[model samples]
Target: MSEVDNYEIVRQKLTLGPLTTPKHRKIRRLLKIFWNEKEINLLSHFGPADEYNSLKQLQERSGLPKDEIKQILRNPLRKGTISKRGTKYCLEPIIPGIFEKYFQRSRDTEENLKKAAILYWDLFKEVLPQQDTKVDNDWSLFRPLLPLEANEKIIEINQEFDVQSQTLPYESVKNLIDKFEQFAVITCQCRLVAELSGEPCKVAPSEMGCFIAGPGSQTMIDGGIRGARLLNKDEAIEFLKETEKRGLVHNAVFDKGDQSSIFFCNCCGCHCGVLFPPKLFHERGAYQSNYSPKWDNDLCTKCETCMKKCPQKAIYHKFPVKSDSSDEQMVLREEMCIGCGVCAINCSDKAIKMVKVRDNVPPDRQKIGNKTFIEMLQ
Candidate 1:
């Protein structure tokens, strides 16, 4: 089929429910087919959606005939710059109103339309069976509005860390919060899913890294734009305290040195590409923690309680070693472990305990923030 014809087909498929206006659907489909397919997929992955697929992989998996697929990929109407990164292709911002129009919806239209849009993007790439990655513990999320000038202060604070290795001073954290005039309750899409589903979210609200400032910041705020639910220092603290009361945790607090903002993340073990290994993206760093979990076999009864409680599914159970006879043994996958205290909390034998593991940041933090936040915007 010609690119135009394919675009029509996609548009027809996308039209559903009250929100799917004919014009809107046509525009979305045209953009999808005409622009870089990889860029569309990347947007879906980065946005508040659940689509994650590489462009080339999607092309190979597409059942369309080679000629038709090539025609769609090479369509001239898809007027956008393509950015290639190690086989990945992304579409530059070509159409001005694409995001605004695509996301426009009445309250009732959201659930279904959002799902359809996400599924459409997934069609282009692989969807691995969902697995928890075991990095959920020791994380947090919060949205605080602070002064934009605080970004400079944060840079100064980080400069001190450049020469020394110590936890952020309580005074520094307090000073930044006090200086900021406003804050916003930033909600992550992944965390939103957990809340809507009534599932126990694994990531803490505090553990989320700040990426709105400095050289590698992942968040973006319009300069001097003040319209959201901005909170002052006292209000911000109250908001965070309420979040914790609702069972959410905080991992870290950051002063971006600009607008006062708090990042609230709902992280999981799996699907959180940032928390996993193989370092798919160079811009993101690792997840860091101040503590690790220690196992005492003597207290263990070979029970598998820890394995079941693990959100990342990192823990395993095995039988004890047989001195001379044949018996099963229990074991823990330390490599896959994220040192969350869930296993220890649930362990009947009390064999697991969280102890200070190291002082370095975990590699996954940078990856998730950079890939999902910064790279997507660029």
Candidate 2:
């Protein structure tokens, strides 16, 4: 087939579900960079979609011998472009799927990481058009994760501990871990993206902040996907606490808001895909973190740290040169805060606190919410 024909097949495959058609030409250019003619030929063997089927099936369709197909498939598997399920092989999606391979390669491949970063930004630009448009359900892909907020510094604020209702399984990272069985730790893709773009995570080490749990981990782990390792319940909780201390927002991807998801990411405002992109457009993306920052003027030292730290730029610093220096203030737009709680993690003055909005708290969740991992994105 000619180059155009080849590009079309790949394009059609990429547009499937979670992966989407790029609204910009740069996305096409980026794809051409990674998937050349030979690679595209091999990829076509899987057809489209992430499904589990035997190698013989692929061989039947590709008309290539098992050995030849295996040779070509090895590269994509190691690169994480595709995954295996026992004797079966399948294609991975784009957004929450194929982009992960870039992080796996980033560990030892700087050139790959840099290229991936460029592509991510380009694709992010492609999605910019959707910023102002509201989702049909007015839902986002992630709920703002509320990790344990009772740090020792809160005592200095001298406020009563009125955050008792905050302790829900979906809101707390530790409790979320308790609900899952299998556990795995992986590199934070967003953090890796930032590092590739020359701004690494200042708090949590980029390599240790992503975690996957539940039955899904069993399948991916057994499939030998890179960038994930099994963890015990206790180990997973400790890692979450460590990430929390680093000031990363906890984004648990549980089904609905109660079922443990395949992964929980310790994300930052600047690097994470959903957070940073929405912040750029002055709003949250497909997912809302379900928490917002509440600035306490009585306890605020007016340091304006929260303003600089917010990924969404939700905090607006209001200060006048003519007024007393202590009059400096930070203002928060309630609708803009996704509730990731980065501002409240370690406030030196304990001024910013994350509170559950009256109408936006997690639902009672009578049944499983997300039927599939990519349902929210698609």
Best by TM-score: 2
lDDT of 2 at 155: 17
- Runs with alpha carbons beyond 4 Å of true place in candidate 1: 1-108, 117-188, 191-261, 270-291, 301-303, 321-330, 345-350, 357-378
Q: Listing every candidate in turn, what is its Cα RMSD in Å to the true structure after a full C-alpha superposition?
A: 13.9, 5.4
Q: Candidate 1 residues 84-157, lDDT tens each?
A: 34544433222111221222111223554345334332321122112121223343211122112222321222
- For each candidate in turn, the TM-score is 0.39, 0.74
Runs in model 2 deviating more than 4 A are: 1-4, 16-19, 23-25, 50-57, 105-110, 125-139, 150-166, 177-185, 197-205, 212-242, 254-262, 320-328, 359-371, 374-378
Candidate 2 lDDT over residue span 1-378, tens digit each = 644566556666654433355445666665665666776776776656545547788788878888887887777666666666567776655566667664655333567658777677655545744535332243334665566544332212222333554445565555656577668876677776767767676756666756767876665466554466777877776776677666676676533443333556777766677566666666665355444567788788777677676666777878856656666678887667666666787678878766555434444431212224433211
How far off is model 2, as Cα RMSD? 5.4
Q: Global lDDT of each model?
A: 0.35, 0.61
